[model samples]
Every structure is written in structure tokens, then in C-alpha cells.
Target: MTGEPEGPDFDVPVGLFEDIEDLKAKLARLTAQVEALTGGDGAEPGEASADEGEAAGGEAAADDAEEEEWQYPPFILLLDPPEYDDELRALIEWVEGVLVPGYLAEPSADARWCHLWWEHPVAIARLHAVWLAWQELTDPASCGYTGPSVWHRDHMDPALRELRGSTGPFAGCVKGEHQIDHRMPGLVPSAWTHAED
Candidate 1:
């Protein structure tokens, strides 16, 4: 009896193994180049050439600087006189184009909205907060697939509720109306205040 099996001969495609080896060589070269660029002496990237303690301290300082820079200022704080107009224009575009059309529903007594919302400082602040949160949350790089839902639940819904409530800045406003005379009530007189002279 013959030792060889009688099944059809199996063979790998020509040059397949060579191609795989070529890819591996290319990958190794790229990895080595990246390591060289990133300071591949088993040290973290951007580690200083100084002593160990000095490097550690430097890293800490860099981290602190990054944290400080990362702190986001509120909309009111972002109003540098030079950049005010441009910033406001961008905000208005987002509000009118994306926010109003996508999220805001028909304004009612329970949920008031002013057409000239920018005139109200409180409305501007609230809307800016919402916009910032939206920017952070809706970005796939910042937050994963569920970011939009999280923004809706944690940021947009609450801000809108407060901003559009009956006691909100738009209290004097309604659908199809913008109250030119709308004014936020002033605080009660202080104890030192006296009768007009």
C-alpha cells in the first residue's frame, strides 16, 4: 500500500510568503524610526536629558502647566474686547443654524424663548455653556459613541430647562415675540440705602 494520501495536492499561492516577510520588514523599520524619534531609551517620551529627579520634577511641572491651560473659561470670561465680535458671530451661527433648528421646540408659556436672546446676558451665558458642552460631547475623539446621549442628559437638557423656564431670562418672551422692554428685576435695596434726598 502507498504511504502518500490520495487527496488533491494543496499549495500556497506564489510570492505570498515573500510578501508577508516584506511587510514585516517594513513594519520593523517604521517602528524603529518611531522609537528613535520618541527617544527609545526605555524612557517616556519628552523626558529631559537631566538627572532622574530633575526629569520627574520637569514632568510634574509640565503636567501642571497642561492642566492650567486645559481649564476652560466660561463665555463671559471669553469676552476679550478684541475677539468679542468674532466670537459672538460664531456663537450666533451655531445657535440659529444648529441649536434652534435641531433641539429647540415650539416656544410655549412653560418653555419661553426670546428671538433676541443675545440681548439677555443670562441667556447668552446659558446658551454658551450648552454650546461648549455640545462641542465636547458630540466629538467622537473626545467621547465615544454614547457622547451625544450623555450631552443631552447631563448638559443640554438641564441648561435648556433652566434657560426656558417660566422664571428664566426669557420669562417676558414667547413664541413669535421678542420683548424690547424686557428687564431683569433688580435686587431689593440694601440696609444702608435710605429715602431719596
Candidate 2:
């Protein structure tokens, strides 16, 4: 054989990622590699293969119904409003009982609890993603890979960085710029005060 490299793009230049598309392509490749190694599946119930489909189609009709009952964007926070659904009651209980008092309420954290943010749709969505990431990286029953290091690297860091970032949902609310009213804020969004002028 002649003196030549064996694989595709064997002569790729060092600065190939200087292009936006090339950078995106490289990122996609990296993400795929990580997913392959870590067993990360896509985000929907029906996103699995035919063999997996048969499993979800089993005697878990109630489970399927629950999944189908979910709203457009499946943020756990949205389950709290309208004040009647039993699922909402449970979600609120879990957040208050576990998520908030344990993690979000910490003074050492870069994140400060925003009781009124659940009212904002965008905040609801972002925080829901964080919560999902928490479930993925923490719950011992989950099948995929997990660890504090992995959680911080893949989930916790990005979620907190975005949610508690300078221009995030708490943009003006974190500092003294716009203050949350201290008039007895509680678990419910309505109980919390807004940053209204």
C-alpha cells in the first residue's frame, strides 16, 4: 500500500472547527459518542424502538395514560396550578418537601430561591429541565450512568449556570435591582410577591 492515511478526513486541518458548521458537526459527533457510551435515550415515551414499544404497550395502561395526560411541555412545575389535580398536589408536595428545602434554598448556592418564578412560563420550563436532570443523575434506581462528578459535569452545572446566570429568569431579581416582596411568601406562586414597579 502507498503511504497514505486510512480513514475518512485523515488529513483534516487543525483549524477545521473554525467554521460554525464544522464546530456544530464536531459537537454532534461528540454528543453521539457520549450517548453511545452512557446509554442516553431520547426524551419521549414513544421515541423507543419497536421492541421497546412492545414493552411500553404492556399492562401499564394507567402508566401510558399518565404519560399521555401530560401537558404540551412536560415541566413538573406546571402540574401545580389550577389547584385541583391530584398529580399537581403530589408534585408541589415533592418540590416543597424535597427539592426546595434541600437544594434550592441553600445560601451557599449561586441559585437563590425565587418563589414567584413558577408563574413565569419560561422559568417553569427551565427549572423543569433542571429537575429532570436531577432525577437522571441522582435517583439510584435509574439505569444509565451516574455520579456527582457526571451530574455536575453534564447536568447540574449547565442547569444552574443557565437558571441562576446573570441574564436568566432571575435577571433583575437576584441582586437589589428588583426585589421579591417579603410579605409572607409560601409554596404557592400567588402567595409570593412580584417585582412589579
Candidate 3:
């Protein structure tokens, strides 16, 4: 009008945006519409629902209850002298029937037989029998070989191939700096006698 360049208004109408608050309301409406179109129900992005939490909690509680209900009994090894004797005899018969034959039949008979010197089934059975006899003969209260000392680590059987390796009980006694001697010397008979030893 006043000798000014009359330019045509190029601004397009971008809906009913009046003030800053009105613009914010329009933006929120558009966001909701976009969310609905894109399969959003206003739930948390990555968190599980209330029902899922309840189920998980129930399962955890059930597992805890099961664990709480579990029980274990005390193990009894040797109760009385009579029971010990019976068990010892049974164990001996089992060794004689099962282990002795297998030992005799093994190939490399000399090496295998000599190896059995450390831990023979027959010898173990005899040892068990002797322990039972000792228990019967001596007073239970005054016996030196009371509780589990009679079946201690040293008295137990050595592993196979004990002569080759430094791992077995025999190796510990023989090779190591320990003065290991047979209690009864000549009384304790040797099972296998190698020519060298």
C-alpha cells in the first residue's frame, strides 16, 4: 500500500496453533496419534508387566519353600564291635570272590602283581579283619587305634603304578624322608615279592 513492495503471503496454515501452550497441545495430540498408528499402548518401553512379575515371584517363592523342606540324615559307619565284624567278613568275601581273580589274570603279570603289593584287595580284607579282631580284643575306651586312625590315610591302599610315580602312599613312605616300618615286621606277610626289592 504505502509505495511498499506488496509481496504475496507464502506462509501456509499449519493448523490451529495460537500460543506456545496451544502449540504444545497440538504437538502432544500428534504424538499420541503417531503412537497409536505405530502400535504403542502407553506402556513402559522394556519393562515386564505386573502379571509377569507376580508369576516370577511365585516361582521364586516355590523354589525357596522346596529348598527349606529338604532334610539329610546323619551317616553311621561303625556302630558296635559285632556289626563291625559282620561287615568286615562280608567285605572280605566280596574281595576274594571278585578282586583276587582279576588281579591274577591281568597281562604284564609281574609288574601288575608287584604293583598290587601297595594295594591288594586280599590284603585290604585282611587288614579290615585284623582291625575288627583288634577292636574285639582291646578295650574300646583304651584302644590307641580308636575312631578312624585304624583306617587312616597311611593304612589305606596305595594307587596303581605307585613305583613309577611319586603320588601314591607307598612313594611317600619309601621315596620320601619318612621312616616307615611294618609294625609286626615278619608277622605281616608280603603278598607280591619282586626279585629287586
Question: What are the lDDT figures for the candidates, one per model?
Answer: 0.69, 0.51, 0.40
Q: What is the C-alpha RMSD of each candidate to the true structure, in Å?
A: 12.8, 14.6, 28.3
Model 1 TM-score on a 0 to 1 scale: 0.56
Query: Please, what are the lDDT tens digits per residue for candidate 1 over residues 88-149?
Result: 77789999999899988888999888889998878788888888888889997568789999
Give me the overall lDDT of model 1.
0.69
Which parts of model 2 are misplaced by more than 4 Å? 1-91, 105-112, 144-149, 174-197
Give the candidate order by descending lDDT. 1, 2, 3
Model 1, runs deviating above 4 Å: 1-74, 180-183, 186-197
Q: Model 2 lDDT vs. the true structure?
A: 0.51
lDDT of 2 by residue, 73-122 (tens): 35554455554245444445655676667656442235644566655445
Q: Estimate each model's TM-score.
A: 0.56, 0.41, 0.22
In terms of lDDT, which candidate is strongest?
1
lDDT of 2 at 3: 88
Q: Between 1 and 3, whose lDDT is larger? A: 1
Better of 1 and 3 by TM-score: 1
Q: Which candidate is the best by TM-score?
A: 1
